[model samples]
Target: MVDRPIIFSAAMVRALLAGRKTQTRRLATSPLRRVEVGDRLYVRESMHLWSAGHDAEVTFAADDRSFQTGPNTGDIPDASLTAYFRMVDQSRAKGRRISRPSIHMPRWASRLTLIVEGVKVEPLQSITSRDAISEGIERAGGEWRCYDSSGTGCLGARESFCTLWSSLHEAPGQRWQDNPNVVALSFRVEHGNIDTLYPNLRSARA
Candidate 1:
């Protein structure tokens, strides 16, 4: 019944929002925070233009090309955002600087929940075509075995997946082909009255 926070790239976050992604893999580096069956993860999307907490409207200014009011900041528009504002505002008012990066987002701000169904530790290269598809790699056509002249499995499931992975994390060792071991987690979206699962509060304006 413990709640875990998982940070997802903006693209992955969108995929989850669209109900296209259901599985994810992570390095098994943190033994204390190891993921297990039945555990729930609150997805935190990477910082973007629309993540400004409690900031009712998008400042959408032309000069602010980076889309942040300042360093490490973005704005989000939602009614529930204000209630969260109060919680952090109290901290800020006492000189406790606000720092809510995507991964560090408060539990109350989470909009997506993933209930873990299974977990496995395996070599990263052991990922199969079926596993790649589960990891949200979409196929273009019937090119399951289509190979390039160089013998690379071009357009193949695992190939496409590796390409996608390299885009987000180029691997600390400088090459994705290094094939480090990872923990793969399969989860199901919990759909129902979320409010009953967690209470929502409206904070008073300061």
Candidate 2:
């Protein structure tokens, strides 16, 4: 019954939101190795925030939308939108937008939570087709497929999973062919701020 932070790309976040993703595999690093069944993982995605004192608003890159913090209006007001853009403009003037990296996102701003249901340690390439599908491969025209980092689609769940994994892990010993040991996590996505749904469990640890 521990809570930890996990980072996901915008595409994976969308898949989780759509109920298409249920499993994830990460290198059996010290941090991931600590995860266990019954643990809660708060997702960290790319986002930006505009705040003034206790007032704050968050815009997620996943869907390019804004959400008001602690409130009724799901959409930011015209005035606030203006200010948000103005802030963005200021950032652009220096050469970038206000987008924050997923790794740096605070837990309080996370919008997706995953409840771990199972955990296993296995070789990265040992992922079965069924498990690959659970990793968020999509079916189109009756073919299970998934896109690599370059957006090229690989046909078949296992094939697609291999491509996806290779694209993300190119280190000498972490690539697909390396057959590195990985922590495979099976989880159910819970859509909401983690703290909002499990205030009592927020401080829990394994």
Candidate 3:
């Protein structure tokens, strides 16, 4: 194998940072398994975001002059993280097994945010929450039957919507399996900010 010297450019550095992505890691702060019917259970998870990869354009700016923007702040991809959380929740409901509950945001996702390159996904009407849940379940390799919270066939309550191949998954140890019911959880999602860790990456061109 040849020892190839790594080289970088300013444009490369700027390009890397020009775009971003976000991720979140959530844990069950309380005993989530005890969630019961008639209880308004919502998946609660802390969110963090960061740039997806080594692009010269990405830069980490701190609200304070000091480095480190605490947690949940940075070049994180907010939209992607939200999408990921929704995906995980959908999967869990469908009886799909999950280990971790952290969100994963990749570079390609950021690239797709643009209008030209981005996809045109219609906002799912709230009238299909059950369908969204069922679809999410099916994608996670679980059998699902559409029904509303009122126990009626098909969806009765709709809040949000999703599309095909636009979902996220748990990354092992994210969700508890023994209990298998995660209605509420808490954790932080961290996006990898190459600019923050190795600032030199931000100066690739220089």
The prediction achieving the highest lDDT against the true structure is 2
Off by over 4 Å in 3: 1-118, 121-135, 138-144, 155-206
Candidate 1 lDDT, 119-178, residue by residue in tens = 998878888888887786554455432223343444678887777777666647533587
At residue 73, candidate 2 shows an lDDT of 38
Which residue pairs in model 2 clash with each other?
none
- In what order do the candidates fall by TM-score, top score first? 2, 1, 3
The predicted structure with the larger lDDT, 2 or 3, is 2
Supply the TM-score for candidate 1.
Answer: 0.63
For each candidate, give its TM-score against the true structure.
0.63, 0.80, 0.16
For candidate 3, lDDT tens digit of each residue in 94-123? Answer: 544222211222321221111111111222
Each model's lDDT comes to 0.57, 0.77, 0.25
Q: After superposition, how far is residue 90 of candidate 3 from its true place, in Å?
A: 31
- How much does candidate 2 score in TM-score? 0.80
lDDT of 1 at 169: 63
Give stretches of model 2 more than 4 Å off: 52-55, 70-97, 140-142, 149-152, 204-206
Cα lDDT of model 1 overall?
0.57
